[model samples]
Target: MHIKYTISVIFIVTLVIIEKENNIISKVSDKLSTQLTPILFGPSLSAPHNASADQHEDRLLENSTWSTQQSSSPASASGGQKHILLLATTRTGSSFVGEFFNQHGSNMFYLFEPLWHVERMLSVESGGTNASVAGPAYRDVLHQLFLCEFSLLESFIEPAPQDHVTASLFRRESSQSLCEDPVCTPFVRKGFERYHCRVRRCGPLNLTLAAQSCKQKEHHAIKSVRVRQLETLRPLAEDPRLDMKFIQLVRDPRAVLASRMVAFSSKYKIWKRWAVGEDLPVDEDEVRKLKGNCDNIRMSAEIGLKQPPWLRGRYMLVRYEDIARFPMHKATEMYSFIGIPFSATVEEWIQHNTQASKEVSGVYSTQKNSSEQVEKWRFNIPFKLVQLVQQVCGPTMTLFGYKFAENKDMLMNKSVSLIEERTFL
Candidate 1:
């Protein structure tokens, strides 16, 4: 009877121990699930809390530790060590390039037309007292606006909680059934919340915060379409603290003319219908003349050559054709040239983001009268037009590797006979 009782006791004890271990594992798994769900779904964590209080507390602690790690680690903090500034004319793929950078986890702050503000200031400063009655007041208002915008953008990036989750996931992934830890949850949630809040607070100031925070580990990337003009960038480049590198992007004149026509036609229609009385359509000949002027490209090249040899290497000339045909390779080369480590994530991001669109086709004549399109100037223009361009811009074009067609008959016959009559003159 005593042996029977001992055997029964031993069986019961074994059963109880096994049950206890199972419960402990179940609790750990539940806690882990709570912590990791947010990361897996990415902004989709909406489940009701079912974990024990202890588990919740543990998750918060894990999160705090992860946050600390992200903040301390240079790689997690700053993405890279270069500030990239993209300079290009309208419809020249500046935005596309900026989007590419943004995908690479680079914080790309965009200024659609920063030059408009500069022009407004210049008009007021130059006109002085003779300026319009509203000029001085407008200038003061613009000054305040510019100051606020610049201040806001100065410190844009920050360390976030979700960054921890991403970092943790990046650190390890396994199939042996691991549960989320409570300690990691709070930090991820907090980081995500902060990021959302910053994005909502748009403008230069908010951008600055995000940028500065990210800069703690990575470099800064800026894309402002308005900085296309050389005069606009000169002052910025002169700033001692702003170590700006320029990437001047250009496209073939034929393509640019087509894009420009679309842009101008839209703008002209808007102005005619809303801001001003009806006006005649833009002269296709005049548009062609203006587009053919390679002044901006020449200026960019001059700037590149004029820089100290050290800085010359910093300026890269990106042709739009090269970007469209070989985005990944070009992007990698660009990042390398700028001394930033190329992230495979960034390459993936660009591929996912820049699926070719209709606008990228560089075709503006289809919707309009194809026969009357501005790009057809190559056919309509007399030989004199090509001769004029060659005479004035041939040397610069040659320096930039643009080969002039040897067939003088092909170019000379299309030259503008009434070149002096063109408005661009």
Candidate 2:
């Protein structure tokens, strides 16, 4: 009798929430159903480091029971802005996961990569792209960004120059939306050089107005590949004035390294250490990518675990494999963490976009057959490189609960040996 009553209460709460979201979703799409099936009504959930291994305690629930009353944000509770950060390195599927929120949260104002603007400024001053951002500097920028202030970015920010790999990071929609500045809105939409849409009609760009134009938003999110440590973000994470949450995306290091190798060559430090005019190697810089990838996540998680009590319930760490393998279930948990309701519109969007295909896609596109993405590294990469990443990133991987295959030696054939072969324990 008690279980029945509890289920009935949950069902009633879900209906009320659906009724609210439908009002918004209905206006946008004719295709989404007015009523979602009962499947979206699972109990609320939080990040699971490793359910089988019991690495971290379940912060929300094993099952979901959706209710708007349950979604908590210090910002919302105190009448301030709510900020969500997508924290991950490149090739970790942060883009795809970010798009999940971008598409689902209709009220959300998205900022794709505010840090890239900072990175650009740093690159100019230092004469290269291979430099790490100072934590304090990064945090100061983020604090203003969370509050919807875009003025600082105007100094070095411009429309993406061309259709390059990181172009999606500077997409105009996010740039325009995150700022409340009247100048920013028009500059990104028209005045920018690369996307010269209505150049003849626009006057001289008032960049100062652009700098100050970030509008405070109800739901503000920014996804970036620039932040290298959780500690760098410690200030905002601990700020009493701001309500912030994090979605930390993790992928198998083998897959990360493989993707990086495909994307960049050794002369390819995306400006991490490219001081002045120094000549960088023109080889596959797997070693540099591997170390940075492993160290950042390992160190970030370690620092996050040791964060102050106030930071609890601020982070949801999800593996790319988990989401790819179980899209509906994982995306539901992700949305739950972000305080967004999972409606049929969101479900339908995922279904429509993720249809499997043979065509290789870039990270920027929201349309991906994500399940296939999880295992592509297995076939695309050679065993020698796999063995190398596994060796170098082994301990870090273990901390994140990523297991190895049974046939470890198969990663290397007789023909291809690692630069330094270390025996696996």
Candidate 3:
């Protein structure tokens, strides 16, 4: 009995000692974690190291939830006028997205494709084209536009806009601000719905009145696909007169190609032939052209996503897929990023356009059942072409959270979403 009692005491004492040691070790570990956390997860680090892998993952998910990272620069916080540039490539659903800001309110001045004239005039003058050669002109025009200077724009207008008055202002009806009374002859007609700009001829746009209207507005926004490189716009972004924000909109390259094939059929004749199962000469000039477009888009996105010093707080990367799926939500987040109120006018327009029951016709129509529009390209384009685009644009697709399908069956499977849930800031 004495030996058994002694054994019990030893066992109990051993367990107590072990528990105390464990408690001490746990306390020490927690203290180390607290002390090292700042160093591990400081501003110097883009992300926390492997020690906080779970935390890092959570942060990525949070960022991907359509939120903008706050800018480190003091200029971003400074208040006055706001300039928003909805930067995108052709056939990337930029027109529809631009409507978000366009419909903000009467207080917002929105311009649709002002760069249209620049590209047109320059393309004619050069007898061909070179975006690099025209980069300075593009920057100057954009800078002036932000400051409500319309005289520079008049120079680009064909027939030379007699004293800043011209009927040929390149889709003047597309802009609600330009279409409204005082800037044009008659006011917007009653029961005049959005996307019916074609039906309501607002007459000639007066550049003087338009500039006056722009100055009266609290904020200004412009949508353009012509600016080939984000890096080229550094000067405009850093311009002291304007507080600028750039939202870089991207779409799956496959979808862009499919949309462009139909929209610019003349230009994409080669692609249409490929869509019909013709042998895609991957080495041909057409193929190289497609590859070059993809490279330019990807390079611009990289510059924006990297958040260079000039573009730090000003740059935002958004996927058309995300916006299409959740138009109002994404628009709200976008407005928040730009520090604007998500007005009811914008919300009502989004609901009307995105949830349309009938198919809206027009190559450049912003109205559509956006959810269906997101996947419509899959049926329109062939698997072979999809493979080619993926090959050329694989890095871009991966960077923007697009997933690849292994086969045609997988490509047609709508149940399997190709958009991986990832964020680009």
- Identify the candidate with maximal TM-score: 3
Question: How far in Å is the alpha carbon of 229 misplaced in model 2?
Answer: 1.0
lDDT of 1 by residue, 95-155 (tens): 6666555545433332233333333433343432222222222222222222222321111
- List per-candidate RMSD values in Å: 26.7, 21.0, 22.7
Order the candidates by lDDT, highest first: 3, 2, 1
Clashes of 2: 22
Runs with alpha carbons beyond 4 Å of true place in candidate 1: 1-80, 106-149, 152-217, 228-240, 266-293, 306-310, 353-396, 403-425
Task: Work out the TM-score per prediction.
Answer: 0.46, 0.64, 0.78
What overall lDDT, based on C-alpha atoms, would model 1 receive against the true structure? 0.44
Return the top candidate by lDDT.
3
Model 2: CA > 4 A from native: 1-73, 76-80, 128-133, 158-169, 173-192, 195-216, 265-289, 406-425
From the highest TM-score down, the ranking of the candidates is 3, 2, 1
For residue 123, model 1's alpha carbon misses the true position, in angstroms, by: 7.5
Clash totals in order: 51, 22, 0
lDDT for each candidate structure: 0.44, 0.58, 0.78
Which window of ten consecutive residues has the lowest lDDT sum in model 2? 31-40
